[model samples]
Target: MMRASLPLRRGMPTSVLGSVSANLARPSSVLAAPSASKFTSLQSNKAPSNLSKRFYSSKTPNEIASEAQADFDPHAITAMDKQSPPEPGADFNVVIVGAGNINFGSDEGPWNHSFRLEHKLGPRLKVVGLIDPSADRAEKVLDVKRKSFVLSAYKDTIVYPTFADYVRNRDPAKPPHAFWVGSPPAFRGREESGRDLEKALVEAFPNAGIFIEKPVSTGPVDEAFAIAERLKSAGNIVSVGYMLRYLKVVQKMKQILEENNLKVMATNARYIMAYEHTAKLDWWDKSQTCGPIVEQATHFCDLSRYFGGEVDLDSVLAHSLEHFEPAGHLRRVPVPEETIAPEQRIPRITCATWKYTSGAVGSLTHAVALHGYNYSTELDIIADGHSLRLVDPYNAPVLYFRRPGDDHEEVVRYQSDDPFFSEVSNLIDNIELGPGSAPILSSYEDAVKTYALTWQIRNRSEEQVRKLGKGPANF
Candidate 1:
């Protein structure tokens, strides 16, 4: 139970900004006076807050230089109009930005996951354009067509080194109708808060439906909210990639809870990813991936918020553990030599707990020390007279249920259901049915709260380590 002094906004739903303290700036909080650089000077030896502020400011030097270089006759139709409903079996054009792990598989080369969009969406969603900072990766992605891809459709796909290049060279008459932003969470800004991808997309294709991947950002909350507001104002059909919410077992769990009218009292979630299977060294570093809580275990964190509602930042507390030594458990998995050079380290395990303004408690445990490919992820929700459990949502989804006095537990399993593909289908449906008609399970604004909660966990864990002076050691 919360202390009497803890502030609570009466009758307000607790899931959205429920954990936000009255003293903290709200999501709508913007800088009183904008400047060229929204960020304060980067502090030395400080783990940056997840909710960093990025104010709307005048153009920076780099932006100005880039604009000067790209002087051209602006298209008469600067922005694409609200798309008319697609005729029967018509193909919708989509521009894919970023060529990282989420866009492609985490295998040896860039093409491993390159054709995922085509494999999943196929001819219905044609790839009209591609953008990435890496020229080679972008070229490879456009050139490769993996199994089950229609050969003829990809012939017209165009590649660009940056969003600016795409805008400059793209046939203004054929702007993309939608976007798939699969860039890393930290790829948003150059120095401060910036949504270069979203800005470019809106400039090229207004009212275009956009699907951005999870952990909306690696920066501060101020910038995340600002980016969200920009997308919302564009009237774009936006959806964040929280695909776990679409799992069949998860849906069934919600149905059972709602139909039974069970009031949730607590939520417990765990995500132990296959540490040995992670091929990318940057994924193991905190500066790059923001640790497991924000990077890998975020799906479970999002689920906790989904089941328990929004979190209260004031009620949050966290503990983390990291160990790297010869013959230690850290030796079991591959660690980059540079990361263990006594100046940098990443947490191997993190456990965080927080309360919802709705008076419910929630806890999440995430670890990156497991072996093999079977990700040990699960969520348990305890409500009035009953409890629910969902296991391994990423691969195979399973739900277990038990009533307070029931003799046996009920089990339901979903076979071969891909939530990623389902999410894409939902995005296409939203485009087809038009905005405000088809439902979007997770929007940018909705997912930012989940991102904020994860950041709270990270910030608290770092503070605890600092206070202890020897909690989690650097390499």
Candidate 2:
């Protein structure tokens, strides 16, 4: 049946990246600009007296990558360019759950999630169908000329309004092997919740593997945990889109730590995003995008857990500056009047402190109000006699390491490595290799712990804001 596909609205890109590097010892430059300390001192009651009216000069991701390329090995770059051909009659057929621009290509061209997946998997993977309510979105993705690289790669792909609709109408001889949930973070009450969509898909495809986006749930820990439990009970292949875990540099960092048996003592990380560049207002609202911590900052939070071990919920401390300045002075991105409650909006700047189960003290400072496009996503670790840092894991990701007695730090660059390729390829391996063989980087259950920490930070920050009773006047 030739049914009309539903049209869905699209949002701006909020890219997430994690840092990793390897070296016994080498010379180093400062990983990134010295961590901005002023964000932590900003108070809700008082406007930032030193706020810079000008946006910081953006260090374009391409520019950063160019610099990093100068340091990388040509052989590594050449190896990453090679794509392995798929064997005949592979059964890893998949379907996408969203048809927005990010699912196909962004404003800049075919560099979005789906494009990366298609290009990386090549013949090894096949996108047999898509599930979205937006007919416009469906129409857009199918327009081969616009996204020729992505659309042309697929031999044939069907479209449906819902997962159930796709499941019901699918050809029994060629059922979908897995689902890639590309929709935004959704909740129970609101229909756009990705979590709700996943539920329906799981109910329809009992043994299907699912690849989900981050901030798995917009609700509390209980809801997130429930989703994790359901997936576990079904014996489903579940992988959360935490791509940093698959970065070669990150893997090397893990190997270095384990090989040397270095104990992590302390960790510091931050995800300072460009708020002014966020054209959409919903992204700033906690009720919509789940705030930066859950929405975007979770990458670094997960990295903290990846290196520092499990977090101690009892020891978490957090704070935020929801309304950075007087409402009159703020540059507001217009949103539907009264669509989101004032109390539900999250702060532009937030900071949280916690203790890992391993006794390592750690902190994460997330700010979305930066003036530049150069995102600051970094993690620093202090272990036994060494200090290691992963800088700007998103754009031009670099790694730096130094020991107690070293005068120079060792550095490794990954300006050319595509972590997403590594992530998608691993997901494919997991589906084909079954249990114990494939290394599923960030499983749904493990990602839930990261989601829990984000909620804990938000809850803690809210409690502090309540005690201060110094709400911003803009609202």
Q: Identify the candidate with maximal lDDT.
A: 2
Candidate 1, residues 1-475, lDDT tens digits: the string is 0111010011111111111111111111111111212221110212213432221132222222123222211111111122233244667777776554445443322222234445544466577776665556656545564223455456777866566677678876666777777654444522242334565566567868888766666556655666776776788888877766766677677667666767679999987655564544544445434555765566677788777775677788998775542322465566564554332356778889999757999999887666655557779999988878887665556889997789578998755555555566567767877753434667776677677777778778767767878643531
> TM-score for each prediction?
0.76, 0.77
Name the regions of candidate 1 deviating beyond 4 angstroms.
1-88, 104-124, 146-149, 189-195, 324-329, 337-343, 471-475
lDDT values for all models? 0.57, 0.58
Q: List the candidate 2 regions with Cα displacement exceeding 4 Å.
A: 1-80, 108-111, 145-155, 187-195, 324-341, 472-475
Predicted candidate 2 versus true structure: per-residue lDDT over 312-393, tens digit per residue: 7779999887664353133644454245567656677788999876789999998755554455677998888888899866
Clashes of each: 10, 12
Worst 10 residues of 1 by lDDT: 1-10
Q: Which ten residues in a row have the lowest lDDT in candidate 2?
A: 20-29
Question: Evaluated with TM-score, which candidate comes out highest?
Answer: 2
